[model samples]
Target: MALRRTAYHYYERRLVATLPAERLPRHVGVIADGHRRFAREMTDGEYRASYEAGMRKLEELIEWCAELGIGAVTAWVLSTENLARPAAELDPYFEVLTDLFHRLPRVAQRLHFTLTVSGSLDLLPPDLALAAKAAADQTDGIAAPTMTVNIALCYGGRQEVVDAARSLVADLVAEGVAPEDLPERIDAEGLARNLYAADLPDTDLVIRTSGESRLSGFLLWQSAFAEFAFVDPYWPAFRKVDLLRALRDFTRRERRFGK
Candidate 1:
C-alpha cells in the first residue's frame, strides 16, 4: 500500500509539471453527481454521512482549483429536479446545503475568493434561502477577490433562461420602453445580463464524474463552447489525481468553438 501511494504521488507530480499555468482554463464548471448513489453503495445507505463526505470532496476540489490558479469555478450541488426527491432524502439534503452556505462566508474570506450563490432561492425553504443570501452578502465586501466560486443550488439551465427573460422584460417595462422595441431587447447579451451571476464568464471546461457521459441540464447557455471531461469515480471517491489527469487531458485538446 505504501509503495503504491508513493508511486501515485510521483505520477501526480509529473502530471502537474506537464501542465502550463498559462494554458489552463480560466473558468471550470463541475457537476458533482453520484453522492446519493455513493452513500447507498459505500455507506450501506447512510445518507447524512455520505453527504458529509461529498461536502469534504467539494473542499478538496476547490483547493485543487486554487492551487492550479484557476480564476473561476462553478459547482452544481443541487438541481431544480432534486427538489422533487422524497422528503426523507431531501430534508437532510436541504440542511446540509444550508450549513454549507452558512459556512461559505468564512471560507471565502480565508481563501480570498468571491462566493456567488446561483439559483432560484424561492424554491428553497426560508432558512436555506436566507443562508444563501447571507453568504453572498458577507462575501461581497471582500476587495479584489482572487477567484470566484459559484455554488449552484436549485439551478436549471432552462429555468435560468426563463428567469432572465422575465427579469429583462420587467426591467424594460419599468423603464416605460415601448412594446414595439421589446423584440430587440431579447438578444443573448441582454438576456445574459439578467442571469443569477451576470458577471460570471462563460465556462471554459466542464467536468462530470460518476461515469456520466452527458450533462443533465448544467450550464446550458454558458457551456456552448466548453470542453468536457468525464471521469468514472463517484463523487465521494474522486481524488486529486483524477483532477490532475483531467487538467492534463484538457491541455491536449483543441477547442475550436464550432469552427
Candidate 2:
C-alpha cells in the first residue's frame, strides 16, 4: 500500500508540474453521470444517499477548477428526462436540487465565483426556480469573479435551441420585421442570443464521467467543436487527480476546428 501510494503521488505530481497553463481551456463542461451507481456501490443502493454524495463531489470539483485557474465551469445537474422519474425517487431529488440551488450562491460568493443557472426555469418547481434566479442576480455584479460556475438543471440542448428560435421569431415580429425578411435576419447569432447563458463562451473541453462517451444532449449547440474526455469512474469517485489528468490530456491535443 505504501509503495502504491507513493507511485500514485509521483505520477500526479508529474502531471501537475507538466501541465501547460497557456493551453488551459477558457470554459469546461462536465456531465456528472452515475450518481446512483456510485451510491449503490457505496451505500448498498440508497438513491438519496447517492445524490447527496454526488452533490458533495460537485462542490469539490468547483474548488478544484478554481485551483487550476479554470475561469468557467458548467455542470449538468439534471435533465428534462429526469423529471419523468417516479415520485418515490424524484421527490428526494427535487429537494436535493432545490437545496443545491439555494446553497450554491453562498459557496460561490465565498469562492469568488459568479453563479449562474442554465436550462428551463419554467420546468423547475417554483421555489427552486426562484432560488436559481436569485442566485444569478446576486452574482451578476461581480466585476471579476475567480470563476463562473453554471449549474444546468432541467436542461436539454435541443429544447434550448427550439426555445431560442421561438423567442427570436417573437422578437422579430414585435420589431415589425416582415415574414419575408425573417430568413435573412435569422442566423447563428440570433439563435445564440436567446439561448441560456448567451453571454458565456462555447465549451472548450467537455468531460463525461462513468465511462460515458456520448454527449447525451448536454450542450449540443455550444460544444460543436469541443474536445472530449470520458473517464471511467462514477461521478462521486471523481477526484482532483482525474481532473488534472484531463487537463494534461487536453494540453496534448491538437485542436483544429474542422480545419
Best by TM-score: 1
In order, the Cα lDDT scores of the candidates are 0.89, 0.88
Task: Show model 1 residue runs off by greater than 4 Å.
Answer: none
True-structure RMSD, every candidate: 1.3, 1.9
Best by the lDDT measure = 1
- Backbone clash total, candidate 2: 0
Residues 126-214, candidate 1: write the lDDT tens digits. 99999988888899899888889999989999999898999999999998999999988778988889988789889989999999999
How much is the lDDT of residue 147 in candidate 1? 89
Backbone Cα, N, C clashes tallied per candidate? 0, 0
